[model samples]
Target: MNPTHHRRRQLRSVGTITAGAALAAVLAACGSTAGATAQNAGAGTSSGSSAAAGQPVSGGTLTLALDGDPTCIDPAQTSLTNTLSLGAQFTDTLVDQDFETGEIVPALAEKWEISDDATEFTFHLRDGVTFSDGTPLDAAAVKANFDGIIDLGAASFLGSSYLADYVGTDVVDDSTAKVTFKTPNVPFLQAAATATLGILSPATNKLTADERCQGELVGSGPFVLSKYDLTSQVVLTRRAGYAWPSAAAEHQGEAYVETVVLPIVKETGVRAGGLQSAEFDGIFQPAVQDQDALEQAGFTLTSRANPGNVQSLFANTFRPLVAEEAVRQAFQKAIDRDEFNATLFNARYAVPSSVLSPTTPGYTDLSADLVYDPEGAKALLDGAGWTVGADGIREKDGTKLVLKLLSSEATKSAAELTQNQLKEVGIGVEIEIPESSQSFKVRSAGDWDYTFSGLTRADPDTLRRDFWSGGQPNSAAHLTESPLDDKILAQKAEVDTEKRWAIVAEIQKEIITQGYDIPYGSQLQIYATRDGVQGLRLDASSRLRLYDTWVQASS
Candidate 1:
C-alpha cells in the first residue's frame, strides 16, 4: 500500500528525455489554488507541427488570456490558481515534478536528502545562480524565503500550510541548508516542488508581506515581472542570462518567447472568442462547450487531470441549517454527480469515487456511498423532522431548508445546476458568484452555508491541509475534537507510506460516513492554443510550464 513502493513500476519513460541525463546536465535548472479545478482535456503533448516545431525559436510574445486577475503575484501569499499560474512564470522552486511520471527532480537545489526520521531535510544548492535583481541565490536566500513565509502567519495561507511542524531552518553554509521539523513531514519534499514554496530574493523577502503582494518579490526564474497592472494585465520579460532550468523544462536555456502577457479575461466566452480570433495566443479555463468549435477553427485544446483533491461542494457545518448531521448527509445524497460531470465537463473529467482524485497517490475507490439517491435524501430529511412546504422548500422547526451557496465566477454554471438539483430534493439554495479573492474571503469567514472549491497537489497530505483544524484556510466542515482530526494528524506524522495510506483511507471513510464533504468529480486542467504553438506543458500539479513554449509562424 506504500505508494512510493510502486513508483518504480509507475515510472514511465516520457518523450526522449531521460531524467538522469537531464539532472546531470542540470549540474541544472529549476522549476494552485484550484481544488484540482477545471482544465481543458487533450493528450499530454505540445500542439501542432509547423516551421517553429522541433526546435525553440527565441522571439515573439505569447499573450495568454486568464480567466481572472491574479489575487496576488507573491508566491508566499496567494493560493488561487490564477495567481499560481502567474507565479510559475517568474518564480523557481527548489524541486520540480516530472509531468509524466510525477517523480521529484532537481531544480534550484541540485540534490536533497531527508533524515531517517523524516524531520530533517538537507538541500545542496547549485552555485552561481542569482535572482533577477542580481542577488546570489544561496542557502541563506532559501532560509530567508522560508522565514518570510513563517513571518506572514495567517496571511500566508497556502505557504504556511506547506511548512507545518517547522522547528526552523539552519544555513550550514553558502551552498547547504538543513530544515528541521518537530514532526515527520513526508509532504515537504513534494511541497518544495510547488510554486507556493518557491524561493525569493532576500532583498524582496526583507519587504513586508503586504509589500511583496504589491509586486516586490523577485526570483531566479526565466522571466522578470516587467509590468503588473492589477485590473488589466501582467507582463513578464524573459531574463537575459537565465540558464538554470528545471530538469522537466523542455529546454535548458533562456525562454523562447521574448515576453509573456497575461490579460485578465474573466468571462469564458471572451477567452474562447479571443483564442479563436487569434487576439490571444492561448487561454486558461476555456468553456467545455466551446471545445468542438475551437477544434474546428484549427486550435488545439489540451488538458491533464489534476492530481489531488476532487472537486466537491463543501458544506459549512458551522451554519445553523447544515449543523445537523442528517441535513448534511441528505445534501450529499441529493447530488447527481454523474449528471453534473456530464453536463459541465463532458466525458473529459473523471467523476470522483472518493474525496481524493484517481491521479493522487494512495487513492482508493469509495463510490458506494456517493450514489445519487433522491429518495434516500428525502427520507433523511424527513427523519430529521423536515417536511416539504406547499412552496416546495423543506421546513424544520420554522426554519426553511434554504442556504446561501458561494462560488467563484469560474464555477457559477455548476453552482446554478447544483441549485436546481438540490431544489428537486426540497432544499433551496441561493447561488452567489463572487470574484475569486472575495469568494475565498467569504468561505474563510464561514459566512456562507456552502461553497464549491477544490485544491490541487500531487501529495495525499493535501487532505491534512484541507481538513486539519489547524490547517491553513481551515475551511473544512467545522468539525473540531472529532476522531477524524486524530487520524489526519497521525497520517501526517506517519513516515511509513503504506501505514500512511491506510490511515488516509480511514480518514476518507470517516469523512464520507459522517457527511463532511460531498465530492462530485475531478477537474481536468484545460487550456487552448492557436495551432503551431509548441512546448506547452501541464505539470503533474496541473499548472502550466511555459518556459520552453514557442510560437511557430503560420504556414
Candidate 2:
C-alpha cells in the first residue's frame, strides 16, 4: 500500500482461471452433496457468533490481539499475515470465493457471467447494497477503485504481475459493472475473490492512495470502524441495518454483538497470557504450546488444511555453486522431511512434496517424486562432478558449494531448520538476520543465495510468478531473469482450463527440473481459537467466513 512497496513491479493480474466450464463440470461431477457434515464440520467463528444458542445478541465489543501491525488496509497491495484484521471491517468484491470450496458466490455483486470467449465479465450488482459510509454501492464506485489503483501505480505486486495489462472497467448502470481484459485471463474470476480486489467505497476512492493512510478505513461489511489510533488499536461497531449479499452466513441481518476491537498486542507470550487470564473472550493463538492450555480449559479448537499458501527455501540461482541442476537435486534429497515435520511441528504438518498443496484443485499425490534419498542425492552431485573434498564440503572447479540464506527475524525456527537440512547435503549455508523491512529490501534486490520463503496465494498463477522466472517473484538467489518463462506466461491469461493446467504443470516441472524453485515443504494456514465460538467456515484460502458463527453466553 506504500508508494515505495514495489516488489513485483511489472507483474500482470497474476490470475489463474483455468476456465471453459471446467469448474462447472467439476462441480457437477462432484455432485451437489455437501462433503462435510455440519454437525461435525469445522464451522463457527467470533465474527459471526450469535449472543445465544438461537437468538442474535444485539451488542458487545470483541477485543483481539495480533503479533504484528497492519501496514495497509488496501488488500490489493499487501502481503503481511495481518490482512485478516482489515478483512472483517472492509470488503465488497463482486464475488468472494468460499476460501475452501472455491465457490464463486456473491459478495458486492449478487451474481455474474463470463463471456463465451472468457475475456469479458459482467457483474449484476445487488439492488440495495451500500458502503459503510451510507452511499449506494454502484458500478461507478467499483470502476473508480480499479482506476485509482492503476493510475497511482501503487499496487507494486498486483499491478506488476496479475494486472500487468489491466485495461479498464466500465459502468453500464447503477446495477451493472463490466471488467474487460486485453485477453481471456483465467485467474480473474478467482482473483476477484481475493482481498487484493476487495471493493472500496466511493468515499475511500476519493482520497488519494497515499492520503488514505492518515486515518480510519471504511468497508461495506457487517462491522463499522468506530475508532483508530494507527499504531495502537482499531475499534469497530456493528452496522445495525446490515443485509448480507448471500446466505453463506447464519446471521444475515444485524450482527449479534455490538462491537469488536482489534488490539495491537505483538508478543506471542503476552497474547497467550491474555487468553489464559480470560482478559479476552478469544484470541488467535498460533503456537502449539497455547493449544493444549486452551483445550484443557474446555475451549473449542478449530483446525483445517489451508490451500495455496506454501513455506519453503528458494535457492538463488545466481551463485555459480547453486547454478547447477545436480546441486539443487542434492539439496532436495539431503533433508529428512519427516524429521523436520515431526520435531518442529509436533506432527501437525506435512513435508511439502509438491508446490500445489492438497487444498488446491487437481492436486495430485506426489510423495514418490519427493522421496528422501541421501545416496541418490550424492549420486546426482557426483554425476555433476562436484567431488567431495577432504573437508567434507563440496567443490567443483575451485568453487565452493556455498550460499547466503536470509529470512525475517520473527520466523527463526523454520529458517534454522533449513540451515541444518542443507548442511546435511555437504553444502555451506551462511545465515543473515535482518529486521522484517530491511530483509524485504535485501530479498527484493536478489542479493541472497537462498532464503526461507512462502506465499499465501489461492490460484496457480501465484506459483507462476514466484518461480516461473524473472524480476521480483523469482527469489531463487541470483538468477532472476526468464525470457522463455515470459513466453509461456503470456498465453496463460487466454488458455482454456485443461490447457492452462497442462501449462501450469509444465511450469512446475520446469522450475523443479531446472533447479529454479527448490521444492521445500507443504503447509496449511493454521489457527488456534478458544471455545464458545460456533458455526465458522475456515475457507480453503484460509479465511474465516464469520457470518454464521454463534456463541453460548455464560449462563
Candidate 3:
C-alpha cells in the first residue's frame, strides 16, 4: 500500500487559522527565544494572549532543550518526530509552509509544477544559493541527497513512506529538477517540505554515514551547525551571509542572533524548573504542569485544535478479549476523557474522537459527537458472552478480563491514570510491562493484548499507514494486518477531493465503530520562551522556524 493510500494513519489535521492569527503571527518580543510559554498536557501551544506576542525584535541567542540526544543528526537516517522538526528550525527545505494555512509556498526551490494527471512534479531549484560549506545547491545536489536516502531503505521510513516510490529524480538543468512517481503522488511537495528531504551539500553525502553523525551539519538555512555531540548537545550559529528566508520573516539577512543552543532534558520537572529558573531561553515541547503554571503566571496561551500529536492505546486484536469488538468498546466507554482533559492534563487537552482528527485535510466530525456510554458498553460485552466472575472481573472460555496495558517510563503516569479509571468497568489493567521498543516487538509479534503508543505527522496520509491493512505489522514482525483496512485505504487514495471526505468519514466511523484502539486525544503542543524572543512561528506541520528572530539586548 502506498503512503497516501490511508492518509489518516498519522496525526490528524485540525481546522485552519488565517494569516495574522496568533500562531501565524511572527512578532518580535523583548526576550526573543529567551521568553517562556506555559505548557499543558494534550494541549499543544503557540504563544498568544500578549498583544506584543506579534511584535518584532532581533539580536540575541536562543537556548533550547530537546527531549533527548538524537539517535542520529543525519536527518535522512533518523525519525525522532521532533528531531527532524528541530532541524527545520536550522535547515532549509525545498519549499516552506504557512503555519496558519499549511499552504506550500516556496523555499530553496523557488517554484514547482505538476503534470496534467498530477503524477509528475518539476521543481525549479533556486540559484545564487549554496550550503553553509559553500558548495552550490544545484539540481544534482538535490538528487544525490534524496537518492541516497531512498537507498537506506528501511532505515529511512520518512523517505520510503513519504516518497511513495523508489523513483529517480531528473536534473533538467543546473537550477531545475523534475521528479516522477509511479502514480499520482500530489503530496510529494508537502513531504518535500519536510526536514527528511532537506537538501544537503555534496560534502554531506561524502562523509561516511557514521562519520556524518551530525558532522559539520552545514545547510542553506539561517543557522549553521557549529557543534553536534550526541552525548553533549547540538550547537548552531547564525549564517554570516544568509539572506533567503520565509516571506513572513523580518530583518531577513543573517539572523540578528549569533548562536542557538539545544540541550537535552527529558524529566518533566527538570524541563519545567529549567525554564522557570531562566536556565534556558526557549523550548519546543509540551507538558501538563508547565501549561497550568503558565496560565496562572499570566503567560500567553496560543493554541489551535490540530491533530498534531498522538497518544494511542493499541488493542491487540490477536488477543481474545481485545479481539472482541465489544471489549474494545468497553475501554472507550470507561475512559473519563473530560476528567483526563481537565484534571490529568490541567485542562490543556482535548479528547479526539476520529482516528483522523477533524483538522486533517479530509477530516469530518463523523464520530466527534460520540459519548461515554457505559450502558452501551456493557450491553456489547454481554452480547459477546463475557460474564462477571468471582473477583469482579469478566471471564469467557476460561480467560479472565485481564489485559496487559503496556507502557514505558515516559507514559507510566498516564498508565496509572488508565488503571484507576478502567477498574470501574470491571476490567483488569496492569502496567510494568516492556518499554516502547520492546512493546513494538511484542505487539507486532502478537505476544500481548495491547500497547500504548502514538505517531505524529503533518499530513492526512499518515492515517493510511497506521490503520490500513498493508500498514500492519510486517510479516517478519508477526503482527496484525487487516484486509478490511486494506480495502478502506485503497478507496481513499483514488477518491476525489470532494468524495474523499465521504470515504474518510466512513473510515473514521469504522475505526470508532470497531473500537480497535481508544484514542485519548491528540496531545497538545507547547513551548517555553523568554520574554525577549521574537520572529517565532509554528506552521500546521508543527515545524519550528526561527530564522527571523531577534533579541532586544542581544550581545
Q: Quote the positional error of residue 120 for candidate 2 in Å.
A: 1.9
lDDT of predicted model 2: 0.60
Best by TM-score: 1
lDDT for residue 65 in candidate 2, whole number 0-100: 61
lDDT of 1 by residue, 1-555 (tens): 654323322222211124323222221221101111223332233322121346677899889988887767787788777688678878898989876666789998899999988899999999889999998999899899898889988888777888987888899999998999998888898899988988888898889877888888688988998888887898999999999998988678899889898888776655655554456888887666655455545566667777677888776666788778888898888999999888777777778788887767667788898999999999999998999999999997798999888877667777888899999999998888777557556667777777777788878887787777665346555454567788888887777889988998898887776677788767777777876677777777778777878887654
lDDT of 2 by residue, 403-504 (tens): 677867645766677678766667777778887667767777766776776666557666655665554543333454665466446535644667776666
lDDT of each: 0.77, 0.60, 0.62
Per-model TM against the reference: 0.85, 0.84, 0.83
Each candidate's number of clashing pairs is 12, 42, 46
Q: Model 3, range 1-555, lDDT digits (tens) per residue? A: 644322222112211212112111212221233223432222123322212345455556778767677768767766675577567756788886555445678788788988755567888976788788788888998888777777666667667776775478899999988887776665567778778888777677766667655555667778887788776777878887887776545455777678888877654444444544456665556355455454344334444344422566766676767777778888877776666666556544556656655444555553443576667667777788878888878788998888787678767767887887776666788775675567556656666666666654555666565665565572111125665565455543442556655665666666666666566666555565555565555555554566655555423
Please estimate how well model 3 matches the true structure, expressed as its whole-model Cα lDDT.
Answer: 0.62
Worst 10 residues of 1 by lDDT: 27-36
Of 2 and 3, the candidate ranking higher by lDDT: 3
For every candidate in turn, the CA RMSD to the true structure comes to 11.8, 11.4, 9.8
